[model samples]
Target: MSAPIQMVLFDAGGTLLGTNTDHPRWYEQFFVEACAEQGVEVTPHQVDEALVEAAREINLTHRSSSDEQVRFFWEHMYTWCFRRLLPNRDAHQLACHYIDRFEVGEYVQLFDDALEALELVRCAGLRSGIVSNFGSYLHVFLDKTGITEFFEFVIVSANEGCEKPHPEIFDLAVARAGVPAGQILFVGDNLREDYQAAERHGMFSVLVDRYDLHADKPALRRVKRLSDIAQYLPQ
Candidate 1:
């Protein structure tokens, strides 16, 4: 068997924190509030549907498109959502306003048990950090959620100039922790980016399978509850 993990690295969005039901509602409310500020009238449901359609289109085209192209697709979607919701406002300004509003505290909510699990990990003498694919505001979100103190490092793809599934980002993270790859444990929801990449780099990897999809993969250690992680570590 492999040695016990001395350090733990986490994927931010789906692994450490459960998705909030308010996530979809936040987008809808932001657009509705922005429309009200602009003196435009539009229903939240209509705007939310347009945003979802835009996201689907972007996801479908992402694999074939360059980074710039993907960004353009997102911009187009934002512009369309804004235009549909507030006909009189400039879409660019509206998009910016939406982003500014998004940076505020009410949009994201942390999972109920996340802090307890994090505390348990910390008390276990394992160093912890976050490797997330997020924009510049990730630190702000973490701070607002009151969980920022638990992490020794926070590496965002936007700041690192690279996203996951790339070995270099993982290399950077390992380097930041000042630990050998073999001594680190990476837990994330993505099979390719989190589990495969970490395993490829010689780190211990845990797959958070909240969906119960891949039960037969013996090479991967799958866990549903974040608190159950303590059981996998050696005392």
Candidate 2:
């Protein structure tokens, strides 16, 4: 009963591009390997705790600035986490190594359904873009993964000075696409940030419930993979 969507916007990170954040070994193994080289043994719990606190602090501080000074800020966050477990170790040096690895796609993981879904958007004659809470330089990962050509633009919260749940960012995305809000479909992983937020703004929203995270929300539309998006495309 709704118009066919003219555009499809996707969230980065968990939706199309995923990393070791969900994979436990990436966390435990990474620290174990790195620390082993220095003759130290650290548990995954210790590293995870430090990272949780560091991320919390960064989230709090993120409210103050929306400028392009992301590198310096992230460096501090990385150092903060590293220092908690490696007090006598070179936290700054360790942080730099980790960040450097990220630059070259050290642990970057692309979902299986990502490419097919993106291609489906193109073949369906719908324009596409990415709306992400991620920082800048996502283009690098996009390029390395061979998906950069699929998107018309990438809106980053760091550059935009605001993130999702803030209507202005979605408003700006719709405006940039030159499409009416009602004629766009947004797909992502978060229940509140991606699904509810997009729905609130008049767009058709679908949640990617890889883990059945929102099964209790009976009224919501859910897809297990990006390839499953075909059912929701405007007919």
**What are the lDDT figures for the candidates, one per model?**
0.74, 0.81
lDDT of 1 by residue, 91-189 (tens): 877675555555564457676656876888888898899987666567878988889999999988766777787777899998999978988988887
Q: Give the TM-score of candidate 1.
A: 0.72
Instruction: Give the clashing residue pairs of candidate 1, or none.
Output: none
Best by lDDT: 2
* Candidates' RMSD to native: 5.1, 3.0
Return the lDDT, model 2, position 38. 65
Q: What TM-score does prediction 2 earn?
A: 0.83
Off by over 4 Å in 1: 22-98, 213-219
Summing lDDT over every window of 10 consecutive residues in candidate 1, give the lowest-scoring window.
61-70
Best model per TM-score: 2
